[model samples]
Structures are given as structure tokens and as C-alpha cells.
Target: MSLLIVGATGTLGRQIARRALDEGHQVRCLVRSSKRAAFLKEWGAQLVPGDLCDPASLPPALEGVTAIIDAATARPTDSLSIRQVDWQGKVALIQAAKAAGVERFIFLSILDAEKYPQVPLMEIKRCTELFLAESGLNYTILRPCGFMQGLIGQYAVPILDKQAVWVTQQSAPIAYMDTQDVAKFAVRALSVPETEKNSFPIVGTKAWTAEEIIRLCERLSGQEAKVTRLPMNLLRTARRVARFFQWGWNLADRLAFAEVLATDKPLNASMETVYPVFGLNPEETTTLEAYLQDYFSRILKKLKELDYQATKTKNQKKKTSLRF
Candidate 1:
């Protein structure tokens, strides 16, 4: 009677695990390395050694598990390929869930995955969604835009460090949600029968373009940002060159995300219909501005503390030397 979380070590997965645990769910984490996932163990999730790439591991992992939160995906840094993990691996997982007779399956997918067949991840996700629908298991597919946590590295850090913040010339606004917010919907899906066999777009209240984010960072950090814009044509050419080699398909697959950003359409979906079902208020979602403000305040305060300590140490050395 445990709620199993696949990809428990991932950014979104970690948040989901925490939310489930906080809400008093019996949590189990399927991970490749239990040692590396010690933090999750510390957070009170039962760790089971399992890998999606190894289909044999699925059956045993699914034993006694009533619900599943599938947040696993083929990351760019993963040793496995998108075809191996995202596509084939997910297929094995779905079949296992159906056989195990899990009560509810919560899948985390991307927004507009069906619209972009050219992107490998998007294409794979769309195919998986169709497969899951036909798998005979009650499922809820949560399609979210981007994660606001990623902006810390993509914009906030580089701006605070006075380094180049790379952006696309044809940038589209994206409504990014905090992973924690998305996690709330995922855990709530288990008890909410209305969410079963349905799909919902879980996104932030407002859509923000890259330019607006850069300006916000500049204002918050009080630092002039070094912005570098990559032309869409150049990005396409880079992707083309990357696809020329068999070994580069992974890189090419990752570059395919550029297509989503290099468009006029916003990467947002209406959440008006979604809020009432999950009993979640729109105001509870974290805004990008507030997220950035809190991050800068904490970071700047730490930086000031470090600077003061360094100056104090230097002054103490000078006094000691003068006396000597």
C-alpha cells in the first residue's frame, strides 16, 4: 500500500517525493543507486534498486505498490539514450503497472508534446501518453510547462556573476511552475477520483519571456547582465550538424528543445478548469517575480556576510603585522 515514485532523484521527482511524504503517504523510491539517493532515504522513502532500462526490475518494484508517480525521463546527462529510456523504458513500466493492477498512475509529461513531432522528447512523450491511455490502468497525465527552479541557473546565477545569459532571438514566453506546486496536484490526484483518466495543464499564473526574466534578475541583483542572444537560424544549423553523427543523436535530441523556444506561440495553457478539480487555488502558485526576489535576497545576504568576514580577517592581519 505504498505510493511508489519513479525517478525520485530528479529535480521534479525529489519535490514529488517530499510532498507525498509530508502528506503522510507511504513512499517508496525506485532508483538505480541507493547510495547516491541517500538524501531520499533520509527523507523517509523506502529505496528499491531499480532501473527503467532494465525491464526485469519493474515487476518486483511494483509489488505491493498501489499508486505510481512516474516523473522519470531521459535527461541530457543520463548514460541511457532517449530511445532506450523515455520510449522503450516507459513502455515496460506501463505494462508492469497494468499487470500489477495499480489503482492510479500519475504521469508527468510536457506541454504541446503532440504538436512537435520533430522534437525527440516531445514525440516520445506523446506516444507514451497514447500508450498509457490504452493500457487499462486508471491514469492522470499532468502536462507542465517549465520549472521555475531552472531559471536560477539559466538566468539568476549568470546575471549575479556578470556572465553571459544565453537566450534565443525568437524567444517565446513560458509559464513555468514551481515543481512543488506541480507535486501538490500529483499527490492530490490519488484521492480525487475526478482527476482519473484525465489530463491537466499545471502551470504558473503568468507567462514570462526570457527578456522579462533577464530584466527582473538585473533589478533584483542590482547588476548589469551580460546577455547573449543566439539566432534561431544558428541554433537550427548547430542541430543539423549535431545530427550528422550517430554518436551525436543525444545532443541533437536535446537541441530539439530550441524549436519550442523559437516560436511566437506562448508555452502556456489555461488552468481555469483545472483548479476546481484539484481544490488548489491559483493564488497559491508561486510567481516568478516573488521566486526571484526571495532567491536574490538570500544570495545577496550570504554574499555580504562572506565579504564582511574577509575584510575583518584582512584588517586583523594588518593590525597583527603592524604590532609585530
Candidate 2:
């Protein structure tokens, strides 16, 4: 079957593409840029360039497409809110798919989209999910836990620099999923012939409190890693500052802080729901110690690369000024 993966270059989306390609499935990916599409094509994905917000650009991309995996993520700083992408964009994609005679719509969602009210991101997810349920199309929804990758972004410097990660008391007990695992489950959801219409929450192996995670890091990395529990007040103020500078910062920060941090994490969200369905179990479960060691190592390498690039750029600019 020809599968169309929207947002094919994103963290979750790219992994899904990789899994699908490994299964010998013909994968077509919708990318926003020619550069990205060229890169994905080089990696063996059939790349179709299109924008999610513009409906007029979709039909050609959807032509002869059999299924869609909507991995599109809305940034809080986006001019359009989640309603635009999660709700309207999803609806448009579904409508276009149905119009094009495509069969299935698989959505990548978050756990507790409906039950959670403290975060706008969840609220938007809930809305899109509700719309998908009522829509007259074959659908499967997958809600994954917080990603280990979410912690790997360049901004995670504070945690890396100190050889420790700070957290509020809420994230004391945290359970997050590896992005690779989430992608595996998404591929299964797409490949499985059964039309299961239930929302499944995918999680990783273990949940560790911030302190426990730090202890693991210290043990694994052979470094003195400390877990500094910051006051809620400081976190909130930081969030406010982020919001002042960015549009989606308020919602994004609130969601991360209120929803994931201040909560009890359970294994229920992990591969338990999906193991039997996918006929696959996680063989490599990353322990807090192992995960941190690898995570820190990667960040250190990236920092070195970035510093080298910046120095090169600065030197080139200085040479240009000297020539003038």
C-alpha cells in the first residue's frame, strides 16, 4: 500500500518513515521544503512537497495515496493556534483523503488529550481527536508519552552543563518514551490490517524520579550528577519570560510544567497496550543511567560541532572585513 507520511521530517515522523521503509512498504512523505524532500528522497522515501495549512496544495500530493500518518506538530509560536493545524489541518487532510478515496487515517496524539485540561496543547489534541472520532473515515489514534528526544533539544544545556537535570517536585516521578519506540508503534498501527478504532497510549520501559534519574546518571557516566529540585516559583517565572519572547511559549511551558512534571507517571502508557497488537516487544529498554550517559555524550559532541562551526563563521567574517 502507498502510505503518505505528513510532517515526514519531524522527530516522530522521520522515525515512522524509517520503520515503514524497513518493512518494505512504499512510503511517500509530505515535506514543506524541496531541500528536506531531497534529503528524505535520498534516504529512499518518496518525497512530495506540500504545506499542511494550504488545502489547495494537498490534492496533488494525495493523488493515488492509500493512507496517511499525521505526525504534524504545531508550535505554540505559530501564527495559527493548534485549532488551525490539529483541528482544521487534520480535518482538511481527512476530507481530502476521503475525497481522494484513501482508506485509513492514523493520527499521532498525546496521552490524556481529553482528560487533561491544564495544557492547551492537550486540549487541542483532544479537540482534533474528537473530530477524528466523529469523522466518517477509518481511523487509528496513537497517543505517546513524553519523548526522550524532548530532553535532547539544544536548550537542554542547563542539565548537560551541570552533569545534572533540574526538575520540579512534580517530575520527581517521570515516565517518558523513546522516540524510536513511538515510531515503531506508529508503523505497526499503519501496517496492521485490523481497523482498530481505539486510542492507544505508548510508553517506554521505566519511570524514574528526577533524583533517581540523576543517581543513575552518576553511576553510569562516572560523574557527579546532581538533581536540583527547583522551586515552582522560579520555573513559573522562567515560563513567563519565555512567553514574553515567544507566542507559544506560555502554552508549551505550561503543558510541560503542569502536565508532565506535576504528575504521577505509570507504566500503563508504555508498550503494554501495543506489545501484543504489534507482535513486538521492546528488547532494548534504556535505563536511566544508560540513557543519560548516551544523552550527555551526544550533547557534548553537538556542542563541540556547533562551537567549531561558529568559530569558522566568525573567522570567515573577519577575513571578509579585512579584505574590505
User: Which predicted model would earn the best lDDT?
Assistant: 1
Query: Candidate 2, which segments miss by more than 4 Å at Cα?
Result: 76-80, 153-160, 226-228, 237-257, 265-273, 284-324
Residue-level lDDT of model 2, residues 148-245, one tens digit each, is 77654421444456644656766535467777777777778766766367777776677656666555555544456456666766666666666675
TM-scores for candidates 1 onward, in order: 0.98, 0.79
Candidate 2 global TM-score: 0.79
Model 1, span 111-164: residue lDDT tens: 999889988999999999999999999999999989999999999999988899
For every model shown, the clashing-pair count is 0, 4
**Candidate 1, residue 137: CA error in Å?**
0.6
Candidate 2: 10-residue stretch with minimal lDDT: 151-160
Candidate 2: lDDT of 307?
Answer: 99
Worst 10 residues of 1 by lDDT: 73-82
